[model samples]
Target: MKMKVESVNLTDPSLLLRPEPVYDGKPVSAFRNFDDDENDPMKARVRKTYYDMHTNMSVDFVKAKMAKWLKFNHFKATMKEALIKLNDLVDESDPDIDLPNIVHAFQTAERIRDEHPDEDWFQLIGLIHDVGKVMAFYGEPQWCVVGDTFALGCKWGPSIVYGDDSFRDNPDTHNPKYNTKYGMYEPNCGLENLLMSWGHDEYLYRVLVHNKAKFPKKALHMIRYHSFYPWHAGGDYQHLLKEGDEEIKQAVLEFNKYDLYTKSAGIPDVEALWPYYESLIEKYIPGVLEW
Candidate 1:
């Protein structure tokens, strides 16, 4: 599955350190509802999805999933091909947009492009961020691939969506070693060392690292933890932070503004936009990649 990738010029340090954009129109805060709204018809499905995830995503499950996917033996396709395949995946776990996931891919990328035109790598990361949800297309269920990820081996923070009511049946909730606040990990153990619930975020992060993609640390952190609503959004899990997470946390929050707000019912013209994104992909992660 290996193919040679030409070296893409890295981002200029000046562009990487640009100040955050001033968002126009409505604030992104309007869309941050993680709890079930009694009037919203999608509540039942969303609740059930979280219930399944919280009930089954234990330390053992995370370990087994890491072993399975970290092998990277699933299949091979270029970044464009993988992004197209996402059109077939409708994330039942997402309460936002019910349209094909490809629309959100372009929406997120386009939003970034509009605001941070100088950060081409950042825009590309937006398009491919959810490409890891392709795991569902390969036989993994929606719950396993699309839900918000949390640290599996630690205490489930109150910030997790439905964290209080859903994990009652989970075995880890009763395990003496894992039931406590610190669980199996020590305080201030950086997120890189903890096992997160298996999902698209972790999958795509690993894929980029294994293939030696040219993304920097900020891009890597955003890819791995975009769905970590509990930490980035809820302001929980500060107790688990290591020394330098302050900067990474800021980047994740900035990225979240685009990821959450850009989702819409409008679909992008995939064929027309293909050329520009293809060039960007070639520049960064060229050739067929391991699935």
Candidate 2:
């Protein structure tokens, strides 16, 4: 189901989902390789839109949104329990493989760790890469947890698994001003100038940043771009990029090759790696992550 039409239909209204582009056009079942589907062609013309950096938001307004969400009881569970629960999301949207969510995340992270054994921080990134999926276990819909990252800029990626096109059925896409190619931004702005949909990549990145952790810039790039398949892999939207963004794009593409093409069932046991990581965390994070 990696075909464009199918990938374009990830959030079928019939399934209560909207159209999005979270794949190379593959489908998943109890048994199927998530990787290659012989006939799927994901390399068509580029899709419009990308994540934005600056929001049209004011400090108080941003604070108000955070305050509203902060009022909710997001979670109250141990990391292990949360990890177990996180797998329950079982992305019906992701068709390539049927591995449980944690298993899928482990597959991505573990491969990253094995090939670059010297990069311990990437090992942690591999292990906890999808920690944002915690939101799935916390009662957010798949649309909320697993979509594209974007800024306050207009017309973000529609292929994000957890979001629906109905999200685009609003005035934003049609409004004459926001409908322009750049929306709320000037041309060639860097990602640092954008704001994305609130999700796990940023969540984990914030944890590392605020605590002054030692995650590599590459690891940080992983957190940010694992979901940004279009620009990195598809070569879309380069017209809006700045001078050096291409180099950043190249590095992200190098990292993405590892992320997409590598997966194995023969890796070392994740359970075996946990004890060492637990110590690493004790030294790195606050008492524990919130959810």
Candidate 3:
């Protein structure tokens, strides 16, 4: 049976506490499955997105993208204005949800609010975490703007969705400086020191800093590494971690639960929720932001 959105009890404390929450009638383990099935359109779409991402996401490519986007010269808009624009985007790399990205944004924020009622900054983080995806409107493709992020100039994590098979076509796979386990990084250099692949995660984190958003450091950390599945979720890159990095991993894990499992949650009344979230936006990330 299809799980109706209304069936989820967002207020149930137990629901918030469960380690393996159910979504759309599937067990949590069933989520994030990257198995190939050419006959399945959703699966095929996801595979193609990752294949393209792996094929082209080289060190030089990521550097060039950073040069293009990090200038913050793109159009300026308030956080709310940027979020509303997501109503037109459907992430091609997501196999789970087909709804406009805006719906997922509210679903994530609302769930975080329910669980961490006092942490307004965390709730705001949830609301705006994907706002960097507004890059899609400026001609960036979904493959680079959405989906999971991994570190560049290092061996690809075995836990990355499609594993080595998907990255076979990438030129970096053959490059001596990038394909090794440690690659260009020294031992214990820490997560922040690594050059992560260019994506919304890095883009929005920089934007928040550049605009002087007042969110706490932990909130900024959550937003920055939430999509770094290989490091946070897959136990990769341990040799590169420094002291206190475990706390960062735990923080990302706490935020990631809502991000991944809330996709099938009930469609929020965004119109009704905006006033509350707007207060949050005003508090932490007010004003027209340079994209």
Selected candidate, larger lDDT, 1 vs 2: 1
Clashing pairs for predicted structure model 3, backbone only: none
What Cα-based lDDT does every candidate model obtain? 0.80, 0.50, 0.84
lDDT of 2 by residue, 141-224 (tens): 454455344443455444432233333544455565555667777887876555555556665565456446666676677777
Residue-by-residue lDDT tens digits, candidate 1, 84-189: 8988878888877778899899999998999999999999999999999999888888888997888776677766777566889888888888877777888999
lDDT of 1: 0.80
| lDDT for 264 (candidate 1) | 64
Top TM-score: which candidate number?
Answer: 3
Best lDDT among the predictions, by candidate number: 3
Choose 2 or 3, whichever is better by TM-score.
3
Candidate 1 TM-score, true structure as reference: 0.88
lDDT for 129 (candidate 2): 65
- Best first by TM-score, ranked: 3, 1, 2
Clashes of each: 0, 26, 0
Model 2 C-alpha lDDT versus the unseen true structure: 0.50
Residue 260 of model 1: what lDDT?
74
